[model samples]
Target: MVFSLKGKTAIVTGGGSGIGKAISTTFARQGAHVCILDFSTDNGNNTVSEIEKEGGSANFYQCDVSNQEQMETIFDEIAKNKTINILINNAGIAHVGNIENTNSEDLDRLFNVNIKGVYNGMKAAISHFKKHKSGVIVNMASIAASVGISDRFAYSMTKGAVLTMTYSVAKDYVNEGIRCNCISPARVHTPFVDGFIQNNYPDNQAEMFEKLSKTQPIGRMGKPEEIANLALYLCSDEASFITGSNFPIDGGFVTLNN
Candidate 1:
């Protein structure tokens, strides 16, 4: 019962796949009624079904986090029938390119999803939290925010914003019982990774995948479950004393890399 979320209602954006799906599934298993918001209908529905199959409470909502109006509507609907306890801003798009290589369109795309998406989720949750005087927010950041990674200019920019946003929210709501924090994971073995490799390295998928994995000093990519477990702890009552902290779950990538 250390990390128990019994009776709590948790909302996870991008809950269809990768770390988001893992967090949703894990939250449901920990006795939470999980609401999964994702743009992919199939991925969202499949995740909910799988959670239910495991005898966990879960529901899927088709959502584009960047759409403020849509997000507000969904959040309002949830608040009407259930008390929102936790919000996870895990819905984001990744861009791979330095400043010169990244075009305006690419920058805009990252800003819309990676930046505005988190803003919308936080905006929607803050009101409910203020009314209830208690809430937890766990944002998914990246090591790129802290470390200077090559060819990740745009991605790093947004992640850096997320880190500071966590700090600002945590400080602003400290007395209101709202805790805001972010998790920075190195590379995780998700379907997105597979797709990235397949699409970009069709001729040398395995080689490229291995190269990416080795980027982490740990010699392998982190698992989705690993990130999900950390998320579970952050949102649980056990972490009530923790706020305004940036957790780097990078498997030595941030520090050990020479």
Candidate 2:
């Protein structure tokens, strides 16, 4: 029964693909009634079908996390019939550019989805959490938040905000029965990674992919499922005593990269 999410309702933003999809499916498998919020209708519906095929309960909501009104409405709507137990802020966009190359538009784009999106999710759920007096939040951060990841200026800045936000929320709600924490993955192998390599290095996709994977000291990039497992635990009862923490699931990249 440990880490079981039975009878609980978990909401995962960006639940359509990549690490988000892995987390959504994992939560559904863990017996949670999963609410997947994703902007991509195709991906969202597909994911819901996949979970349904597995005999798990799930629903898909097309959402733009940066849209406050949309996020608030969806959260409230879901809260009406189900007790909101967990919120996973896993929706984010990535950018690769240092300060010199990153324009204001680029910084703004990442900020909108990575930083504001997390804020919106948390804001929309905090009230219900306080009313119920119990809730868990797991945000998807990045090792770039703590380490000097070259050419990830905007992405790193946003993730660092996520880290601090986790601490602040956990501290503020510690006595309110709400727990907040984040997972900072080094580099997870997801569809996004594949696409990134294929699009940018079409001639040497495999080589580029391997190069990126080996960047992790563990000799490979982390799996989306691995990150999902960590997320499930953080949102489970087994982690009741855990909060205000940042878990670096970076394949030792943060520690061994020296």
Q: What is the Cα-based lDDT of residue 83 in candidate 1?
A: 97
- Give residue 158's error in model 1 in angstroms: 0.7
Model 2 TM-score (2 dp) = 0.99
lDDT (Cα, tens digit) per residue for candidate 2, span 104-190:
999989999999999999999999999989999999998989988888999999999999999999999999999999999998888
Per-residue alpha-carbon lDDT of candidate 1 for residues 193-215, written as tens digits (9 for 90 to 100): 99999999999999999999999
Q: What are the models' TM-scores?
A: 0.99, 0.99
Candidate 1 regions off by >4 Å?
Answer: none
Candidate 2: worst 10 consecutive residues by lDDT?
A: 190-199
How accurate locally is residue 16 in candidate 2, as Cα lDDT from 0 to 100? 96
